[model samples]
Target: MTISLKYRIALVVFVLQVAIFSPLLWFTFTAYRDADLQQLQTREDVFMRLVSQLGRKALLTAEPTDFQLFIAPFSKDSHINRIILLNQSGIVVASTAPVDLGGPLPVQKNERNTVWKTSEIANATEQLGAITVHFSRAELDKKVEALVKRGIPIAVAGIILSALVGLGLGSLLTRRLKALEQATRRMGAGDMEVTVAISGNDEVAHLAQVFNEMSGSLRSQFDELQQVQQELSFQAQHDPLTGLPNRLLFDLRCSQAIATARQHKQLLALLFFDLDHFKNINDSYGHQVGDAVLRCVAARLTMALKDHNLIARLGGDEFCVLIEQLEQEQEAAAVAESVLHMLTVPLECEQHEFFLSASIGICLYPRDGDDEVRLLRNADTAMYRAKAAGRGGYRFYSHEQTSSVQERTSLEQRLRKAIERGELRLNYQPQVCLTTGNLVGVEALARWSSPEFGLVAPEKFIPIAEESGQILAMGEWILDDACRQMQKWRRDGSTIPRVAVNLSALQIQRSDIATLVRRTLDSTGLPANCLELEITEGYILQDADRAVAVLQQLRDLGVSIAIDDFGTGFSSLSYLHRLPIDRLKIDKSFVQEIGSTSRAAQVAQAVVSLGKTLGLSIIGEGVEQLHHANALREWGCHEGQGFLYAPALAPDQLHLLAPFKRLP
Candidate 1:
């Protein structure tokens, strides 16, 4: 609805031209009419003066013929349609149009006539008659009409000429303004790059220049902010070091992958991998080398997986792989195997060769577990199982494995609330002298009585605690409670030697184990020698040097280390010497078949002999039958604990589990 500047400028010029010329044309007509009237009056005056002189003689002594002669010129000159002359007697003497020759000029003015009158007197002041001259205005009217007729066309033509000239100038000036207007419109529509081509030095041109400058500045600023936003967005989801998706992004991708596989009715796998011996590598070389190895591993994984799978680094040498659209569940094993093969290629960093291998555990959708957390946890548990078997391979989760994983998850959830719910308690199983059946010590066992599940076995939930990293807290709690119970028994005057508490590999791995032990003894007011620490051979020999250092550090505090479930692990005999092991408890499987000529019974006999040769105390677990205890005593086993003597009893029922020889 806007009027363009081109037409507006033309309209202004046209209006100005009309305003100036109208007044000039009107004044021209008025001036011409006034000059013509003045000339006519002068001519009439001169003729009248001449006629009055001639008429004086006629009036005084001559006849009407002389008056007629003077008046005849007036009629022929066309200055008058009628002329009149009057004598001193106040009567008309002559006239140009001779109607009455002396009619006294009719005594009135006429609409069509121009009249002039003058007085005639003698030289000495004598009174004389007045003479009046009459002339017709028809000729003056004709000239005024002619001038008006001629000037009208000229005025109109001048107006039109001014309009064309104005249009030409306006178009030339407004062209740049139109360009600026277009540019402004584009900028309003979010086009910051829009600019005008300014050519002139007028105000419009200057305005266009400023607009271009502003557009450039806005474009520059917009680009900078856009780049910054992109960088921030990328950094939020990516690992800056490996440039891989972090845990948060991995979870998102996992959810998406699950949804996609579900929609397509296909199977997918989630693989969780942890580098074997990574910590040892970090300790051997330096952190820089470790970082280099991690980066190299990431590169190798990326190359191996390509676009067929989603790979992410889940922090600290742990990585996850998501394989989608799997036609067969076995495809997951192939992907995992390829990853293992890729990682096995030794990495040479800083002129030193570093060997890398990973343990990968796979959980397939609709088979192992469903949700992201369940899938991730299942894969991690399977990974730990793979580590238990042997490193440097892949494992596809089985149904039993999945059930175990679920049980672990459920147990962990319940165990976290166990202390608050008062479901966890220590049951002391008495250890007796194998020969005389006298009590030597007691091993504290943890029992969970869940309101929902009833009595759950320790074997089921203990491994769950170890895998979930809750064992550290559970171990500390057990030690504190066991030490306190031992002190209580002492106050009640019991002769029990020591109270033994079991430790997991996770507990042994901590540098704070000594501190935890010391704090527990100090808080419970129990002597360090009365609180025994038990660990599995498999766990202790995993990192022989670290375990030795840790166990010796505890032994230096007056606490003893007993190897539990001996003859079951692939423990090197040298580890026994390295470790300050004070005792060895024969594995229960070996003691069950003690009387039989079974390999298990022979292994138990060998273990008892090994403990004797090493000058360490030996005990037997799972001693159920009289012959089992007799066989252990014959094998030189110093002590035993199992159902044959008594089941684990509560603190107040220690008298029920009182040490006595087995009834025959």
Candidate 2:
């Protein structure tokens, strides 16, 4: 039932040989027997013709001896079986067989012998008798047997040769087929690299070639799929903008670090921070610049920390760091400081230089919170506190700060609605010419009177506005309101020479302040010269070159620029001279400590000298005492503004007061 190809092929060949040679051998044997029988028949005919001629004499003589002599020769040749001579009376006169010499001619014929009868043997006048001859069939059988013996060996050899050829051809095909099968099996077992060797141009070879091509294509596709999977996994866990680990990945690593810390009873700290006023950068310059800034920040943060520290972008401007196996909590502070310092460097994007700062909050393991959730929450709380405390610093988590942070959050929400609720207004304080004791200009200040929390001070709310991005809108409101009030005062015949408006660092850095000033002046129909814009000394020093350009633009619009809170920041004198400023306002703290502290007086004197030398006027704020005013005047200070002159007052009240009057 089940047969190998070799055996099957051999059997088929054997069957074909037998079918072909069997017929051929039988035909050869049959032809040989026929030829031999034809010769035997020819000899019998000749013998009968001869006997007819020769037997006449014997029949005439009526001698048995004569008949015997004529037929004896043929009988001895082994072909003639018998010969008989009969006379006219139908009796056997002569016979080759002696027993038949006296008897009548035999009527029975032998089956194995061929009988031939001759015409009558007669004399000249009448017929005498007939002669009969018999030929043997055994010689034909002998010739056929000889032919079969010669043909059998050749046929057997031919059959054997055909079987060998069939087996060899079968082996050639099966070997290649077996190799392809093995290669296919290997491919099925996940070895896609396997290939079959092709030998000939036959179908099996073609099949092997196709298999090799398929294996290579499959391997290529599998490699591409694996690469795509790896890329997708990386994209899933990383920030697309910064290439830093995303929030999900950060949380996972933080949780793992916490576990390790817990098991080892080691200290770890979680630090959270975000860039201050980063939104302003995005709002002012476009997201392209914002994204570039974020990338730079991520790179700087990575460079700032140790290799073991894990840093991640929690999204947008926020980032977190996990510091494990810390020796002390103070180490976290050092790391935070390094990070802040690294951020302080100028970031250049699309030809615009930016000076950035961050407020960082750190929380230690077990001391602040046990788990990542609590730790991150507390760190975020501390960061908000750092932002509220004027930003550009770091704070450790404390239980006391949480309530205040919550309150700040509530206040920020209320402040967002403050402008719509009409809870905001402006007050103007009088600025006097110290030499003439006459009112010159009034400084405009923002005041918020909330229905829920009445009369919040500028000190409490301004920083909140700046940090929460509310300052941009508030700054616009203040500029418009101040210009409107100044115009109103002018309409009332109040000769307030100029109105000074304070500019937050956010307003200057995040927006085109010069353009806003021009728009406000045009809208209010006020002269640009009647407005003085005050910026803190520290903010100007952040990017002195950009600050100088912006101040120059404002000055070109005919508005006066003042450095508020002067001598407080680390300002380079080289940059001080480059500033397009009209006045330097001594910080209120220094002004208040003028008589109490010699160092404060000396700093105030130095500022006055610097301002005068730069051809700019000096204004001393918080000149509460008479001696403070006298001391500032003696130092060549041009103007003063404080409670001594007047607290910031309502526009109507200020209009009621004489514009040129000296306060008591």
Candidate 3:
């Protein structure tokens, strides 16, 4: 089915040779035959003319013997078979053969070997008998046979020579083609180095040259593609900014490490840590600086850990370390301490020095968890515990922490449903004018009374709600409920001036809090001036510019803004004057320490004086004793609130008590 190039070329050449030589050989044979036949024709004509001239006299004399003598000699010639002289009456007078003497001339018809010719013998218009001559074809046949015998060998030799030349040419031409075909096959089998040898300027040689160039191009492209694939694979597994293993690679290697640890019964530890207050750095500086810091942290961590231990960036400022073949469980703590110590040194990036600290959590194999997921989760929980206990420290996994996490998770689930089931309510604590004991405003406090856990404290569930991202919904509900309650109190003829509702940092950061407040006010038909929003000082300082913008929007809508727990956070006077604020609440710690410590008293007095200087109203919180209230009033505080006046009361109770004035 598949013919080789050499054989195909040979066949084509053989066919062409046959086509050309066959016609040439045939023409040569034909021309030789024609020339021989023409010579024979000339000889026959001369012999007939000679017979007619010699026999004329004899025929006129009517001498048969003389004619016979003359013809007999002519017949003896090889070309002549017989000669005769006839009388005018058509009678045979003489013949070389005696059988034809004195008989009419014999007629020859359909003869193979001989032919006859006749001529009239006349002298001076006197009619005489005809003379006849018989010519044999045997000599012509012998000459033609000899010619054919000679030409046969010559034609065969010429044909054979032509065939040999064709075969040789075919082989010579196909040799390069065959080599190219083999090279093509090798290239097809993935040998990009394969190339054909070029020998001539013909099409096949050009084709080989083109194939070689194509093979080189393909080899180069393949190498580039392989390199690109490797780079893509590395990028997929590595963090682009820090050049650390990403979460995907970390998970894979962690799984593998867990399996090995389980199989070999070896101790393994997973350390989870994240930079403390890293968002503040990203907020204060640009993300470029933050990225440089992360890279620096990654490098330090890599150097701090053992080579066998795997350290990976688990996204953001969080990282995980896998320590295997630990001799003791305390080794994990030692590693954690080493990592913390390594981070104690300041890092400089973009010409700024940063003091970095981290909270680390350690979970051991077969002790804290048996698998990667559990180990990571427990380590994260312990890391949070470290952060809560004040950062730059590490904590090991404990059953109490697991119990707490489960309890918090359960609380979070219940809290989500509690908001929908309307189990949450608001209590109003009256804020009295310290100068006149007149009711100025009341702070609306959220209270949750779950059927499963009665009267759950705000401190416990508030943080849980914030962490689980349910604070947005819960904050919205509190704002709406507080506004509606204030409206109802106004309708019931209560003299409460305004109602303050607390806002969490998550609410402001994660949601459009200004819009939410405006919508709530419009829906409740509550006067904006009659509503106040309380945000913690720490939340405001976290992103001061954005916070100022959001507060400015609220102020434009005639809503009051107050800084809650003012002195407890990193307060900056630079942004404080820029804030759209109406009041600053003295932190309860300072209020509680009023009569106990002169330092606390001085701090509170300074806050009040600062508020006065800023032309902002100041309120003292947790004023539990007469001395505390007297101290706040003497210090020129505008308002005061504590159990001294009243505990947070229900709406109806507050309505009932609104008319009464408290005297300190």
Candidate 4:
């Protein structure tokens, strides 16, 4: 299907040369032979004229012998095969051939012959009888044949020369083309150093030079592409935020380590770590500062572990470490403590220093797991146990911890299906006006009534929901349900003035929370003024600026906002005025010890004084017993709720309490 470039060029040249010479050979042969024949004819005509002049004298005398002598020399010419002289009487007066001397004038019949007829004048006075002469063309024909024979060799030489020249040109062209072809093949085969040589300033040479430049350009681009691919590969395996091995790379290396440890019958320790209360850092500071702290932690980890271990950021503030060839399990604990001490030195970002702590879980090879997944999982479970054991510590993976995690996992699974199965309900807790001792509003609390667990506590599943990212949906449902219930209560001629719903940190951080709240208010036909949304102090301060912005949007809708569990976290009192909050609910911990000479009671009294000073309403939460109520009222708390008056009850059971305000 494909022809060689060399042969193709040769064939093309040969055909062109033949085409040019074929026409040239024909034209030269025809024109040259014809011109030579014409020249011979002219010579014969001159000789015939000379014969006519001399024969005229003899013609006038009417003497045959004189005419014969005059014309005899004419016949002696080489081109003259025969010559004849004629008189006016049409008889042959003289002839080069003696046989026709007394015969009538011979006819000039041969078409190839040169014949001339003329009449002569005697003494230029009287015209002599016409004297006709004829000359033969055989000699001119022979000369033309000689010329044709001579031109044959010349034409053959010309055709051969044309072919040779075409072949030479084609060879030169193909040589340059072949060089480029070879270079192209070499470059295609990944040889970046190959280049074509430019031989001249012609178009072909210019093309070759451009090709060489393109080769260099392609090589440069190829090298750059390779470098980019390498960077991308590295990025895929390592965390972009901290430049540490990412989860995927960690898993791969962990697997290899497990295999190697098994083969050498060596002990391997995997340390799973989670930054303690990391969300609080993101809350008080920002994610930027949180990321900086994580980077600093990674740097510290790398410095402490050196090249003997594999360290990885397993996403967020969680990192993993694989320490191989551990002589004993205690070595891992020592390493964990060393790393934890290094991390506790306090990381600084944006002129803010953070003292951080990490809960580390260690799982040893052959004791905890024989593989990567089991080892990583077991270590993570133990790390959570360490976190539960009050973080800033390390724990070894054990069978007991694994069972605990299994139970938690089962609980998480059941909780996920709880919402869809309608296993959740809202319980209303009355908020009493402390001065009036009358009900002002009610707080809606979410309670799960799962058939499998039978009244599981919110404290247990709330953390699971938060960690598993289910809190957002749950928060939305709670908001919508609370608003709807408040609307129903108003329609039922109940005197409830307002309904408060708890919003999780995840809910407040969502951009759509305002839209969702507005939609709930509109659909439930609940006035925004009668709906109070409560968020905790620490949660709101996570991204304080954005939280303030979102809270402002809710406030714009005429909704009341409150800070729940006040004094438990940053207190964040400096920005309390900046936040569009209307109330502060004293945390139960403080209210539990109220009226006692305890620090909690003092903090509770201070919170109430602070709320009043800031022109905000105060509500003491979990207020039980008569003394607690007297203490909250003395502190100028405007509202209080607890088991002292009544506990969280169902809607039907709420009517058992005395109606107040607008109860119909």
Candidate 5:
């Protein structure tokens, strides 16, 4: 369908030749011949002049003999076709036509000149008579014909020779061009092996050479593209990091396995494997070490699986194993145990060693659901149970387990719609001074009363909400609600302490957390000092510098920041001194066990002393026992909050509690 370069070049060349030669040939045939005709006419004028002089002499001398002698010399010239002299009476006095011409000169219809009278000539010729001459055009035609007959053949032969030479050169030019054409066809067909042979040093040859280089470059690019496409395909069906079958491949295999099992009436098991505290490892060390750990884990997983048992990575420290033709669920459970056991050993990469564990969940065919999504969800739920039960374990999927997962999933859905339904409310837990027993602050706790499921616990739905990104909206609602409550109380003449709102990791992960908090404070008309933002120490330590910067910005705005659940995170207390923190709330885990001769009590005292040494106010949480509150006060804790005092109450219920003056 594509035209070749050779044809195009030849077309251009022939057009140029015709354009130049056609005009030149036209000039030669018309303009040059016309100019020759004009010169012949001028000669006829000379003959006419001689004839006129002879006739005038003859007419005036009254001697025919003298006239003939005068005209004889002019008539001897061969070019004079005809000469006629007319007298005053329009009679022919002399004729050079070899006969007496007519009294009036013979004139052709398209005559060049016509004489009227002596009066018309204005008497310019005194003794001269009018003379007319006609040249022999037939003889001129014969001469012109002879010249053309002789010259045109030679001119045409020269043109033919030049055309042949031009065509030969054009053919030579097209030879390399043809090779380029073939090369282009091959390149289009995805065959880049073809190469053009360029010859000579003409511009066409140079063009061919450039085209060849371009073809080579394109071939290299195509090869790289092929490699990239293959890599993409591989990554599509497999995990790029672990080089193992990914979730897509896992789902495909699971669906097919379920179908085959249903057809053959065979038992199959789907096992979900989760690496325990994998994110913590990744955070403590860098992702590189974590990747090395994952690679080791993948190798262990593959080794533990049978050839028929398929294993795939389900992304982010989670993997799945499909056991085919299993006789019993225990068979799959045994394999899960093997994998968990294999993961226990310390994995070494370079000089670093990582110790990791896996929590495995098993779901069997015919007993569990017979579909991909159902079985995977069931197994994943059981795996979470195993992890919650303390990892280095395996759990078999049961109907109860499936129900729990469905409930959790359903809870997550409801939580998503919770804020929109206006089912969420904030309950204020009073944080009072242990000595004076006066309210110092209130912790904001989110309570959801769903129409579908009434009074869901925070522990049940908070994590699900957090994972679904709904926590951000829910957290914003809590902030506004709590701040509004404080404003309402201040307007109602009830002494209001700081309103402490728990902030989730997801909430603070937003870089705009400070802005959102400031805007909420401004909108609620609540002073920054009256609002407190509480974040767990573990969340703040994830990205210390960034978290510290955000906290410092909030602190500068007169907003109080308390490290909730202190001494529970793995961070060293020394970093706490440098943090722009206002208070440390001892974790309830320690406060609950205080005075029980338990290590939890010692941990609580350590955190209190650490807070005091750093000039930070220490608030003891979960202080249900009077002894716990007395111990915290003796340990220099500045505040206390727990069931030993009043628990969280609704905004209306806060009016009944004893109030304290706001801190200046």
Candidate 6:
């Protein structure tokens, strides 16, 4: 029902035409009628004048022929209906009406009231002196009728043309508005394919242009939002550093695998892998090095497993692998072994080489409770059991192993309590010079005088210490105990031998190691020269720069540095030349076969030559026989530590060492 602008304009124009022309048309018709009437009256007057002239000529000359001449001219005027002449007595002399012309103007009707004289005329000749004229009014009435008939058709044609123009314009404008409405609806429903087709320099066309631009902008924004959403989803399910599936993704895969295994009556195995002493690597190196190590581990695990198998990082040093559609448990074990072997090889990072290892635990579906949570927990328990069986190995989930895991877990809890109970003590093993038979140094060894466990082995507890980050505390206690022993030796008028304390990978890589060492030496009032820090060669080779810096700081404090288990590493003389080392302790593996095999003798001789060239002393450890000692001395090794001389002893056992003769 809405009206378009063109229709409304046309309607207004029509209304104005009617308002103005109705009265004008009425006036024109009246004027036209009056003008025709006036023309008729003028024609009648001329004819009457001609009649009067003829009658007057006849009266003046007494000639009827003159009258005939003028009357003939008047009769030729076609617009006149009749003409008549009347005397002063009101008698018609000549008449266009036949009856009125021949006799006295019989009673004059209102239409024929134009007479020559009225009642004022008296004498017969004066009053009856006649002038007659005649004319017809029918011609004037026909002319006015002709004008009205011609005007009516033209008016009708004009109205029809105006309507057609209005309709055409209205249709064009309304269609554009309709198209705009449709496009708006489509855009509202999230479709940008619709476009309003309006081409002109008018307002509606401009509106259409704006609408198209709006749709384009909205579509672009929607696309960008979708991309951002996808990126967020990727980050949520994947580890940012390793680009591997994270725990959330792992859980989802685990659930799906479990469901499929149940349906097929097959088994799914979940392998939980924990990096052995991974934190010690971080503590010995830096977190940057730790991240690199993790990336390397992830790469190795990925390569070991098949494409269908799933591997995911469960955060930190923990990762999980799911083996689906496996034929047997051995298949999963084979994969775990491959991972273990590949990871055990040295990982080279920024010129530092590291021998990384993993402890793997396997749990099977249906047997380990076919659920994600149960599988994950069982796998974790089996992994700890693997670590307990000595790390860099794998263990399968069994109900029997549960008791052992619980016992180990309980032992860890008690070990924490032991520190508070002050049950831990230190023992010292003498480092004897092979040639001089003098006690050159002592290696401080930690022992747990546990009230419950009685005595615990270092191998059993040190892994626990490394895992729980309690090694830092245990290391601190060792330092304190060693410094105290040095102070006691000095107070008793005995010359103080250099006390070598082993530093865990974590302890030596600490940035504040220098401060901690200085404080420990100060607190015990032990001379810095009497303290020697023994670090494993594996940790030092991981980051030579960091290791050298820490060693230099210790050296600057008047303390000595030695690389323990030196021969077993990828020992490059280039790195050794850069290290501020005072001694190189040959690993027990080489020392055990010394003087027994040519290969062992050659390794021992090479180490002695390398140590002498680097201006570092060589100490051979685990020399259990006299020939072992004699061989090391002949090889020019400076010191030897073995059971042949003395085992690591308690503080109270020092008197027994005093009575025994020193080794030659």
Number of the top lDDT candidate: 3
Q: Which candidate achieves the best TM-score against the true structure? A: 2
Predicted candidate 5 versus true structure: per-residue lDDT over 1-664, tens digit per residue: 8755655665666667766776776677666568777887776665555555666666566454565555556565555445566666666666665466445665544433322222111135553456555455665676677767866885686567557655766777777667777888988998976677777788868888888899889989989999999999888999988889998988998899888999999999988978876765565456887888888888877776747468898988989989888887677877877887787787886466656778888888878787999899888888977865767799988788767777877888778878888899889888987667778889999999999888998887886776567888899889988899899988998776789999887787643888988899999999999999998887766557667788898898899999998887767555667789999999999999987889989989998888788888889989888788888888888888877677889989976675432320
Query: Any runs in candidate 4 off by more than 4 Å, and if so which?
Result: 1-236, 263-266, 275-294, 327-331, 334-359, 386-394, 595-598, 659-664
Worst 10 residues of 6 by lDDT: 113-122
Per-residue lDDT over 474-517 for candidate 3, one digit per residue giving the tens place of the 0 to 100 score: 99999999999999888988788999999988787767888899
Give lDDT tens digits, candidate 4, residues 1-664.
8977666776778778878887887788778777876786676567656666767767766776876776677577765656666666666667888988768866667565565555454556764545655555676677678777887887778777767776787778888888888899999999988899868988879989998999999999999999999999999999999999999999999999988888999999999998876876775566888888888888888998885579999999999999999999889999989978887686776777666789999999989999899999999999988877877999999999988998789888998888899998899999998878778899999899889778988887888888777888888888888898899999999988999999887676544778888999999999999999998887765556677888899899999999999998765666777898899999999999976788988899899999898999999999887788887888789888988778898988888677532211
Which lDDT values do the candidates have, in the order given?
0.81, 0.84, 0.86, 0.83, 0.77, 0.78
Better of 2 and 4 by lDDT: 2
lDDT of 6: 0.78
Clashes of 3: 0
TM-score of each: 0.70, 0.72, 0.68, 0.62, 0.59, 0.69
Model 1 lDDT per residue over 1-664, tens place: 9877787898898888888888988998899899999998887778777766776667666375766776677677655565565666666677776784656556555565565466473335544455566567888889988997898788879888879867977887887877888888888898878889886788988898898889899889878888999988788888887898988888999998888888888888899999986764564445787888888888888888897668899999899998888889778888888988887787877776766788989898978888899899889888876875678888877767766666656778999888778899999999998776678899999999998778999977786677567777888888889999999999999999999999877776654889889988888899988988998887654556777878888999999899999988768777787789799999999999987878988899999999999999999999999899888888788999999887888988888864374531
- The TM-score that candidate 1 achieves is 0.70
Worst ten-residue run, lDDT, model 1? 121-130
Q: Candidate 4: which pairs clash? A: 283-542
Q: Stretches of candidate 3 above 4 Å error?
A: 1-182, 240-243, 259-266, 273-309, 315-318, 325-359, 384-393, 434-438, 510-512, 594-602, 625-627, 655-664
Runs in model 2 deviating more than 4 A are: 1-171, 174-243, 246-248, 255-268, 275-304, 314-317, 324-331, 337-357, 364-378, 398-410, 435-437, 509-512, 597-601, 625-627, 655-664
- Give the clash count for each candidate: 3, 0, 0, 1, 0, 19
Root-mean-square deviation of Cα positions for candidate 1 versus the true structure, in angstroms:
6.8
